[model samples]
Target: MNRRKQKKLTNRLVWAAAVGDTCTVRTVLRTGVDPELPEADGTTALYAASVHGAASTVRALLRAGALPNTESRGITDGTPLCGAAAWGHVATVRELLTHGADPNLREDGGAGSTPLFWARNGASGPHPETEAALVAAGATD
Candidate 1:
């Protein structure tokens, strides 16, 4: 495939993963598509997987060289860790942390909030697993 076609395929795969379409994700990966392609908003396949709580997809993307800390998709201030934490995906958060995602990275656009802050504020109550994951990943306050 040419460069343009390859880019298109990559974008489709990223979108599919972001929407939690695991079947499509698997197929796309099997076709040797790049897993780190970022969407127009700067959201990568990893970010999409994290946002949709697709642990398997996230793992596949990570294994395929997707950077856990990549802040593409115009969300330079937000990390995959933050997305997982904010959405209460404990497993995803842990996976991201284990892959070197920084939990204390401040949000983009001067939000001045870390993943832990977003996790706590967005949570309904005390979530021990999420809290523990964030803390273990070095998130503060």
Candidate 2:
């Protein structure tokens, strides 16, 4: 693929994950598109799926070799676990944890917050299941 086509495909892949389009995600990957391509914001499709609570898509992406702990540096610079926890997606958090995402890995900037911090203080407030999962995974406050 040319650069423009590659970029567009990457955008589509990211969008598919963000919108919870698991079938489209599979189609895009089946067409030889890599699941780990980073968007402009440094987010992989896996990160987007995790953030949006797309649990099945998260599993599919991970099965396709998406790195569970890939971090990005944007306004929200954190790993997939951070995004999932921030949104109170307990199932997604479990999926990511099962795939080896590190709940204790802190965000890159600001207070160096971990997924535990986001689970406790994100816009959704503290989610008990998410918090429990993080705690079970050895996350710190």
Candidate 3:
């Protein structure tokens, strides 16, 4: 695919993930879109799905080969695990961890925040299950 087509398809995939549309995500991935394609501002489908608490979408994307630790560069730039945990999505966090997501990765924007930091301090309030999942994964190290 040409760069333009690739970018467009990536955008579609990201949007689909953000909206928790599993069918669209699967369709987009079927077209050969790179699961980790970051939008111009750096948002990725996996990050979008995670932040939206779209567990099934996250699972589909991960099974489609999305990197669990992939981070974006744009306004929403963040790791999938961080996004999931920050939003109090225990299932999503657990799924990412099951896929080997590194919970200790600092926010790519250079902040000291890890998934645990976000889980413990999300604006949505603390999510004990998310935080516990991170600890169980050795994130405190």
User: Which model, 1 or 3, shows the larger lDDT?
Assistant: 3
After superposition, candidate 3 runs with Cα above 4 Å error: 109-111
How would you encode candidate 1's per-residue C-alpha lDDT over 1-141 as one tens digit per residue?
687877787888878877878778878878776777675567688887887688878877887788887765475336677777777889988888887777777766335667787678754554567877898767787
Candidate ranking (lDDT, best to worst): 3, 2, 1
lDDT of 2 by residue, 1-80 (tens): 78787788888999999899999999888877778888777778988898999999999999988889887666446788
TM-scores for the candidates: 0.82, 0.92, 0.94
The CA lDDT at 109 in model 3 is 56
Candidate 3 yields a Cα-based lDDT of 0.89
Q: Give the TM-score of candidate 3.
A: 0.94
lDDT of each: 0.75, 0.86, 0.89
- For candidate 2, the 10 contiguous residues with the lowest summed lDDT are 69-78
lDDT of 3 at 78: 79
What's the distance in Å from true for residue 49, model 3? 0.3
> Model 2: runs farther than 4 Å from truth?
109-111
Q: 6, model 1: CA deviation in Å?
A: 2.3
Residue 130 local lDDT, model 2: 93
Candidate 2, after superposition: displacement of residue 61 in Å? Answer: 0.7
The Cα error of candidate 2 at residue 24, in Å, is 0.2
User: Which lDDT tens digits does candidate 3 get at residues 1-141?
Assistant: 999999999989989999999999999999998998887778999999999999999999999999998787769867888888888999999999999898798887557589999999985999998898899889884
